[model samples]
Target: MFDWRELLLRNQPQASQTDDTTLKMLEEQLLDLLPPIVSALNAIANLPIEPTWFQSEIAQKFKLMLEGVEQQYLVAWNHVRNAQIQKLEEEYRIWYQAQLRSDKSLYRTYCQWQDLLIQQHAQGWFSWILLGLKEHPFPASELKKGHSFAPETELLLAEFFRCAKPLIQTDTYAVLKNFYSFQAIFTHQSPFLPQLVQGISNSSEKEISEKLEDNEFVEAAKIFWDILIVEN
Candidate 1:
């Protein structure tokens, strides 16, 4: 039982007030979008087995999620981009004044602008963490790596798998393995189940620049569900 607080905070530098503000904003944005995203995922969980029905449900749900992720990332990207330009201007202004061997006010403003850039980068990391948590699965031991943020990522993925594992069926395995195991040599008659799921996950992030639809993540989600079904 690793302490999340200890793991998240140990050796981590304290964020300044400006950084804290930006992080809070990023956190809020993520929290706001989480409900709709989870709802879309839950809809995916309820998909039926019929080919036509499943395809319709998957398409609808995937389109919704993809649009949402793309929108959010684009907004964050613009904010960071703008902040970069402002940061450079402030730096140039500071350097020009530095030769005067005075101007404490200019120095203070420059530091504040630099902090803004730092804050934006932190938010970028937030975006990565949010999507990674949604798609990836990590074992508990992996979360507790000595002196690292690895634990936070692992914890989040572990929690996500716990929630999403209940929807899929263990019987889907044979089909899933065939669909995903493209390396099969003699499988002229490979099953299509894995291919279907892969296709759905692919649609979920088609427009998003970063790949949140990692096959390993999807596989881990399926495995987690299978193990749970077996245990019960």
Candidate 2:
């Protein structure tokens, strides 16, 4: 019953566009893209952190929230964002304890558990990505595509990166670069189950820097996700 056009345009303010205001104007239009994605994200995060935390009921609700996406990429992104949330919470707790001058030994075991749990949660990211790609290979025409000419695609790419970058580690320059989640899936405990799995077995990294112009970073992430979801 939800119209995506209405969702994407609701409460979105149109800014004045000068000749030099091309991408700036575009980012404002893209800003409305967060509402549904953020809503879905908040819905499922009530679960305890564990391997079987993704329940069928929750998955169904999540599926409804993102009707057009493949299940696996959605799952992958969910895990990735959860890991980020856990990491941020852990970091905040550490800062709080430091301020209180708490003894380090009191929270050592809990911190260790947080580290391992975050890793475990993030492990299946690209494996799901691999399986999704194997099931539905991207159209050849969509590979490494740019949003420079396509305003709609630009808005979509910007939203995906905005949702996804939270879980991905960034460097000093604010570029999302590290994807060590590959290390988890390839390890002994977690295995890629596809019989003829075609995926990037090694660590996958990207060079999209957020320090660039808002739209440029979105365009850079366009290439990243194009390669990520479709390039297998």
Candidate 3:
């Protein structure tokens, strides 16, 4: 099993060393990076990947995509070096806010989000690899109040009640919203997904949600997690 904490620690920004200017630069770089990363993930999700392939030659890319974005964002701004990245984020926030007012648009975004997750779920990556990226958090300094990646993250996930107003049709919505909540910015761990995976013989959205709400579902995995965390 992969040690979730290793990825958690690796995902954390070197906020202690990142000055305001550098932080802003890194944020801008991520704003630029995520769209295509999102696209790349979507492309990979549709493929049939064997277990062997994921361990070599960037086949691990899907699992490491977030880390890739963070590292690439921190390394250089060559792509957006001359452009105004802050202004772009502000522009995005404004545009995203407008999307909130249109149920059609927000639902479309929701579908895109759901479709991507479902596709990945088919590949058996949901509980371990994929969900970790969805819920794993960054440092407080990386997600500072309303700046850096904060607005982007919030605008992307912040208020689910509003962003997902038109999205609550089934019990699954309730479960997923909690996972994507904006409050995630303030924390570093989300082993909750795997907790839900315990004792699941076959995985599906419905099955996952059932395990999620059943407290007893994770009873057997308590020792496993304790050992997993310590080993990592």
Candidate 4:
């Protein structure tokens, strides 16, 4: 039988200062920690059946060692995992705020461009008529008007979209998408702003982002709850 205690002692590293680096190192170590025990178990299974007391005693010792190692590793790993998650959640919040600010700026710029175009180009009654057709508010061929505003506005929009593309492609976007998925969850009579604030506060922005981008929603609600409900 394999010396499980000896294997664990040989593989375990010396204690280090507590930090993300230490946690990461511990996580890596834990991943490989149990494989030797598994191999030993496999080896024992392959051996010819023996009802011998010595063989039974060895098997019992291996079981106890495996349990002890598992318990220790799990406790250590959970501590690291929670810390890493919290760090990620903080990062997500920052990213989310920046994203909101960027989107708001782009919308404001678009609205200003539209208002300026209407003021300069549309006459009294014509402007009213144009406004009435909200679905097609922008004049056809307005881009061809040779106006400086049109070119300037186009450039602004182009730059906005270019900068916004990377953000939309991220995991953070996924969390946002999920949050918005059920409109009724935060719609009229639901006190949207408070809920929104709470959700943002509780959310593990980075984790949600990753899960969303991967199109995985199975655990999304739980994470969302952690951020918005549990954490808050």
**What lDDT tens digits, residue by residue, belong to model 4 across residues 101-132?**
67443223333433444343213323322232
TM-score, model 2 to reference: 0.26
| Model 1 lDDT, residue 68, Cα | 53
Pairs in steric clash, model 2: none
RMSD of each: 20.6, 16.9, 16.4, 27.2
* Candidate 4: stretches off by over 4 Å: 1-24, 46-51, 54-57, 81-232
**Model 1 lDDT tens row, 1-232:** 1121232243234323235555454444444534433443333333221223343455465455445544544344344443653454354345434523553432233334333323433233233333433333344333233223254343443333332222223333432343233212122334344344444444332321122233344335334333322222
Best of the candidates, TM-score = 2
Q: Write the per-residue lDDT of candidate 2 for residues 118-148, one digit (tens) a residue.
A: 3432334323333322323333244334333
141-229, model 3: which lDDT tens digit per residue? Answer: 44333334443333233222222223323444344434433234345555454444342234444443343345322321222222323
Candidate 4 lDDT for residue 214: 62
After superposition, the stretches of candidate 2 with alpha carbons farther than 4 Å from their true spots are 1-38, 41-123, 134-136, 148-207, 211-218, 223-232
Ranked candidates, highest TM-score first: 2, 3, 1, 4
Pairs of residues at least 3 apart in sequence or in different chains that clash in candidate 4? 171-209, 172-209, 202-227, 203-227
TM-score against native, each model: 0.23, 0.26, 0.24, 0.22
